[model samples]
Target: MIEEIQEQVAYYNARSQEYDEWFYRIGRYDRGLELNQCWFNEVDVLKSALQDIGEVNSILELACGTGIWTQELLKIGKEITALDASSEMIAINRKKLNDTKIVSYHQVDLFSWQPSKQYDLVFFSFWLSHVPPTQVDDFLAKVYRAVRPSGRVFIIDSCFEPSSTAKDHFFENENEIHQRRKLNNGQEYQIFKIYYQPNVLIDKLTQVGFQASVKQTNNYFIYAEGKKINKL
Candidate 1:
């Protein structure tokens, strides 16, 4: 499993350049632009999840590829620790931000990287999908330990439950993508799958001792919220 995960990370790291080009080649500068727009459209849903958070003093964003939320957190005056498993992505983030004081970028595996201090808020945007369901319990426990009492956790992900639209989009056919990649050594590769469901993720979070809930809309990705319970 570890090897599989590492392989995925290394594959992504190797594609940062091509991925960057692909993102803009078709006039979609941000691959997540649609997702971000959907998020803003449903910002109220996110705000409700974060209502208890009075002031976000310190934040940790896991799998913060290219500082998407990093910019938003900085705009709100929160100190951020942005981390990702891909060094190439981190390099892109660093170059984009120019090593600003408010943003600290780290290249580390989320599962093994231990936090030096607890944070006021912990967020994972479009990250849980990359994690296989079996390891979710351990990941949640780590996240619960990383937040202070009353701290909140936010996650934005996709639903595994099939939708009519998604079915037509990708599920309706298996040969949705036919593009192939050939490495310099002549090895060939193709993307398999890159999506997940909300219920599976929420159940895993609850099993790990969190109070989790989900919010869904046509405009955005599935939104899940959990709060760390204070020990009595």
Candidate 2:
């Protein structure tokens, strides 16, 4: 399991330079202008939902890739700590954010990294699906500890939409735990990718002592917002 997780980190590190291309709909990820418009539209939907959560004085973002959502969090959070396993990803993130004083970057493996302190919110984007099924409960427990009482947790992750990937890749069986991903250079890596249902995830979060609600974007993403109800 550790080896697999390390490979996942390596893949992200190697792909960091091209990561934003996927989000920007450029180069290999260009699906078409129409689909790209839909993508940003759904992204706006998620953004609006995050804004609706109201202001947070402090936020900790786990696996914050290249600061895409980190930039959004800055709008609502006075102070943000963004952590990822790959230093390369953090480098790009820092460059993108232009050394913002309001945000701190930490490069640490999420599986072994523990929070040094609690915050008003603990958030992660497109990261939960990368957690192996065996570690989901433990991971949420870590999130619970990182958030203050009455504080919130927000997560955004990919849905099983076939159009969400590059044109060259095909959607795999939903039940599969590992998926093969390729870089623009055609190098391949295996990573953990799980498609979680909103309701089922809500139940799991509830069992972990959260008052949670989850919603799906029209077709592309699943997002959840939960408030801590009790200590784990």
Model 1, span 1-232: residue lDDT tens? 6666666676667766555443232222233556445445665565454554456888888998876556656654368888898888888877778778888878888868777778878888767766655666787788888888877788876433332121122343322322234433344444323354567657777776678787775644577778777765
lDDT of 2 by residue, 1-232 (tens): 9899989988999999999988888887888989889999999999999998888899999999999999999999999999998889999899989999999988888999887799999999889999999999999988988989899999899899888888888876887889889999899999999999988899888888789999998888899999999754
Best candidate according to lDDT: 2
Predicted structure 2: clash tally: 0
| Candidate with maximal TM-score | 2
Q: How far is candidate 1 from the true structure (C-alpha RMSD, Å)?
A: 5.6
lDDT of each: 0.64, 0.91
Off by over 4 Å in 2: none
Clash total of candidate 1: 4
Find the 10 residues in a row with the least total lDDT in model 2: 168-177
How big is the positional error of residue 55 in model 1, measured in Å on the Cα after superposition?
A: 3.6
Task: Give residue 217's lDDT in candidate 2 (0 to 100).
Answer: 88
| Count of clashing residue pairs in every prediction | 4, 0
Off by over 4 Å in 1: 18-54, 160-196
lDDT of 1 at 92: 81
lDDT of 2 at 25: 83
